[model samples]
Target chain A: MKTETTIQGLTASLASARSSKKMIGFVPTMGNLHEGHLTLVRAAKKICDVVVVSIFVNPIQFGVGEDFDSYPRTLEQDSRLLAEVGCDIIFAPSVEQMYGTQPRLTNISVGQITDDLCGKSRPGHFDGVAVVVTKLFNIVQPDYAFFGQKDYQQLAVIRQLVQDLNIPLEVIGVPIVRAEDGLALSSRNGYLTPEQRAIAPKIYQLLKQAEQQLRQGEMLEQVLANISTELTQAGFVVDYVEARQTNLQPIAQFDQDLVLFVAAKLGSTRLIDNLQINFKT
Target chain B: MKTETTIQGLTASLASARSSKKMIGFVPTMGNLHEGHLTLVRAAKKICDVVVVSIFVNPIQFGVGEDFDSYPRTLEQDSRLLAEVGCDIIFAPSVEQMYGTQPRLTNISVGQITDDLCGKSRPGHFDGVAVVVTKLFNIVQPDYAFFGQKDYQQLAVIRQLVQDLNIPLEVIGVPIVRAEDGLALSSRNGYLTPEQRAIAPKIYQLLKQAEQQLRQGEMLEQVLANISTELTQAGFVVDYVEARQTNLQPIAQFDQDLVLFVAAKLGSTRLIDNLQINFKT
Candidate 1:
């Protein structure tokens, strides 16, 4: 597989494939790819005539005081893993290449849904995602873009962005890849210490328990409070434990498709996980 | 020439042209078939293989009570005009088709430059333009898009938006098309009564005089004040008369390419005009 760094170079590589009407599948990820990202790439390979994986750790997505500087950069190892997965092109652009010396004047804001859940705590976070994803979508012009469902809000934000802007492409959400102990795979998971890593699976476990309790007709607020208390007791500085509909709208009582989301800090590493549950009533 | 009223129809119409490696040119308008718009189309025809004109009276771009409901939409006449000018396709989707029942969650905001000039008076105006233009650009997927420099700040905004978003298309700004008397042609000119129409050309006249004075070593503020006073005395409720660099940054003294901008109301019709002057020094 060929690797290109500049936008021109990437577009040049895709020109012949595009001219021939090849179905281009794209997977955009912050570098330091793990099993979750590979799953997205493998899925793309199964469907597309050409698969492009973009590995740029977007700086704008990180809030001030967030881990923008310490974010992993394992290009050499990441390239090997992507090659193994048969990625046709690996686009790795420097920060300067993506967002030049000039301040980016364009900002894309996805409303309403962005004001709740992860968006509520991390202000302007989804706007950064929306704008950067828009740039990536335009640059790559992919037929299909695969995003891991681990970033459930981000996937939803992208979906809404694509729809609202009428960007002519399909957005495919891949199920989250997890470790044997059920820790959702993420590049940020690398920030966890060994002990913190051991406790990471508890996030998914709480989501699962929350899902089961909701299924058993427990009160929504009670279930949420119980999960929050349990997570706090487990030494996590609980950020949020809430239940919402697929659209991120708060559910009064789980009567439709629901996602139970949880975020907490295990030391310096903030971990997030969600479980989707379809209610039949 | 094909007239498509839906996004799908327009895409289907252009698919073959796109696959056959034809260069697509786009001109987005609100469809009153003015000379200024036709000049843009003519410019596109000269540079592109297929010219697609989108006649969308974008509601979002109009501020509340700013003539959106009463804006001239002469599709039948506009289509005739386009065909006469060798236009290939006219994509005119309805507001319902463009926006749909769902709320458009996406908003594209361009900063700094949008905080002044037309943007300052009409808040969220450039943002609306930015979002709709983005949508149209994606839908048409043209190799180049044309805009009239009549709305100088708008052209600037689109140019900045395209660059910041890395949209893979060229934005060509066609010079303002005007009547023999020098009123910049606009669909809103339809709002002017005969007496108001008679005085409309004065907007352009003032801009021209201001440009000449600034070139002849007139103080920037003095020239702007003179133009505003002249326009007000000529029966206009002057909005603003200012000078700025092409990038819309305020210029204390003209040392680079500059634009003298004017906006005023003749009766109830608000008219705007600008004249570009290249500074030799």
Candidate 2:
């Protein structure tokens, strides 16, 4: 796979691909790839003639106390994995390369949808995501973009952003890739200690139980409280446990498309995961 | 010329043009076409194979108690003028067609530059302009988009937006078109009575005079004050009269690319104009 560190180089490469009438697919990631990111790449490869993957641990997305400096960077291993998956190009730009030394003046923000779930705990996180993703979309000018459902709120935000901005591209969300123990794959998972790693799967297990309780016609609030209590009892510091519509709007009943979202700290590593539950009734 | 009121129709038409390798030039306007708008259209026609013009009197740009209800719209006449100029398509979408019933959640905002000039009088005006222009840019996907320099702050905002968003299109600013009397051409010019119309020329004349004084080493603040006083004395309610850099940053001296901007009300009708100044020293 070809690796480009500059926007100019990537655009020149993509221009050649476009000239040949190839449909470009983009997958943007914050480095330190795992099975989840590879799944997105594979999905892009399946539908698009050319797949471009961008790996930049965006500084602006991390909050003041968050892991901006400590975020892992493994470009060598990441590129090898991408190449093995038949990726066309990897755009691994430096922070200065992506965002110049000059302060940025333009900001793209989506309201309402960014006020719940992960957005509540992480202020300005979705805005950072929105701006960087917008930059990526423009740089790649892709016909389609692949995103993992693990960042469910982010997926919804991107969808809303594209529609609101009139950006001409399709956003496809691949299903969440989980471990055999039901733990969602994340780059942050690398930070988990052996003991914390053992307890990580419990977070997903509780979400599944919450889904089952909701399916069995339990009260939404009761199910949420129960899960939050269980997660805390299982040695996890729960940030939130809530049920909402797929669009991130609060849903009191499961009559529509529902998503059970959870963000918790197992030791020092913050892990976020969600499950989309469909109710037939 | 083909007219499309729907986004799908325009995209479909542009898609065919793209397949045939035709370059699109776009001119976005707020109906009631004047020589200024036509000049932008003419500029687009010269460089591009397909020229598309969109007339949207964006409501969000107008502040509360602004002239949104009375904003002049001459679609029939605008269409005739566009056709006469050999325009390829006219995209005049309705408010509902563009925004739909749901409120827009996404906003594109540019800082610093938007805090002065028209942005000061009309709060949230540039943000509104930024959002709509961004939407228009995405919808048209033009190779080259044209704007008149009559709205100098707006032109600057668009330039910044394009750079910040990484939008892949060249924004060409055509010089401001003027009436023989030195009054800048504007759709809002129609709101003026014949007397007010005759008085409007003085606004541009004073701006030119200010530019001359600044070039001859007159103090920036004094020149601005004199012009504001002159405009207010001439039966006009002066909104702002100031000199600044081309980027809308405050200028302490006439050492760089300077612009003299004026916004005034002549009997209920507001007019704005700017003149870019170059100092030899």
Candidate 3:
């Protein structure tokens, strides 16, 4: 697989691909590739004529006190993992390459849904995502763009952006790929100490139990409060523990399919996880 | 010439054109086609295999008391004019079709430059233009998009939007078309009374005199003050009389190529005009 660091090089390659009647699928990531990212690439390869994966550690998405500086840059290592999964091209543009020296004057913002969840905690995070994703979408001009459902709010934001803007591409959300211990796979997971890592799976475990409790007709508020308290006792500073509609709308009582989401701090590292509950099925 | 009012229909037609290797050019207008708009269409026909013109009276762009409802939509007449100019398709989606019953969650904003000029008077105007233009760009997926330089700030906003977002199409700024008396052609001119129409040319006339005065080493502030006084004396409520660099940067003294811009109201009808002075040439 070839890697392109410049927009011109990538567009030149894509122009030929388009002329040759190739259906391009794009997977955008901040690459410190784990199993989760590979699954997105593999899924793209299964359906598209060519799969282009973008590994941009978008600095704008991270807030002032967030992990922008410490975000991993493992392109060389990420490249090998992507090749094994049959990625056709790796677009790894530098900060200067993606965004020039001038201040970014253009901003894309999604409302309502972005005001809660991760967006509330990290202000302007989803706007950063929307803008960078838009630039990538314009640059790659893919037939299908794949995103991980692990970032449930992000996926929702992208879906809204695509629909609202009438962008001519399908947005596919791949299911979250998790570890054997049920911890959701994320590049930031690399920041955890070994002792902190051992305690990480508790998040997924609590979500699963919460899902089962809700299925058994447990009160929504009671279940969430219990989960929040449980996380605090387990040494995780709970950011939020709540259930919402699949679209991230607030739910007073779950009557239909919903998702249970949690975000908390374990030491200096923050981790998030969610579980979808399908009651009708 | 064909007209499509739905995104699906337009995309299908574009898909067939793409298969047959056609280069699509786009001109986005707010209907009520005048000589200025015809010039844009004619320019598109010169360089593209197919030219698609979109006539959308975007509601979001209009302020609370602005003339959105009164915006003249001369589609039937406009269609005839376009056909005469060898236009290929007219994509005129209804407001409901363009934006569903749900609120538009996505917003595109350009900073700094949008804080002054017309942007100051008409808040959120450039943002509305940015979002809708982005939507049209994504939906039509054209090779080249045209805009009239008559709306100087708007053209600058679009240029900055395209460059900042790295949208994959060339943005062409067509020179403003004027009448025999030098008044810049605009659909809004239809709002004028015969007496008001007679006074309209004074805007362009003043811009020309200002250009000559600046060229002959007249003091910049004095020249603008005299033009403002002349416009007010002609029964216009002068909005602004100023010179700025070609990129719309505020210029204290015009030493190089700059544009003189004027906006004024006469009997509730507002008109805007500009003249570019090329000192370097």
Top candidate (DockQ): 1
Off by over 4 Å in 3: B252-254
Candidate 1 structure lDDT: 0.91
A1-281 in candidate 2: lDDT tens per residue? 89999999998988878987898999999988999999999999999999999999998888999998999999999999999998999999988988877678999899999997888899999999999999899888999999999999999999999989888899999999999999999999999999999999998898888888878888888988998999899899999988888778888554677988999998779999998888865
Residue A118 lDDT in candidate 1: 86
Candidate 3 per-residue C-alpha lDDT over B129-225 given as tens digits, one digit per residue, 9 for 90 to 100: 9989999999898999999999989999999999888898999999999999998999889999999999999999998888888889998889999
- List where candidate 1 sits over 4 angstroms from the true fold: A252-254
- Rank list by DockQ: 1, 3, 2
Please state the CAPRI-style docking class of candidate 1: high
Writing each residue's lDDT as its tens digit, candidate 2 over B156-236 gives 999999988888899999999999989999988888899888889998899888878876888888998999999888999
Docking tier of model 2: it is high
Residue B79 alpha-carbon offset, candidate 2, angstroms: 1.2
Model 2 alpha-carbon miss at residue B161, Å:
0.2
Better of 1 and 2 by TM-score: 1
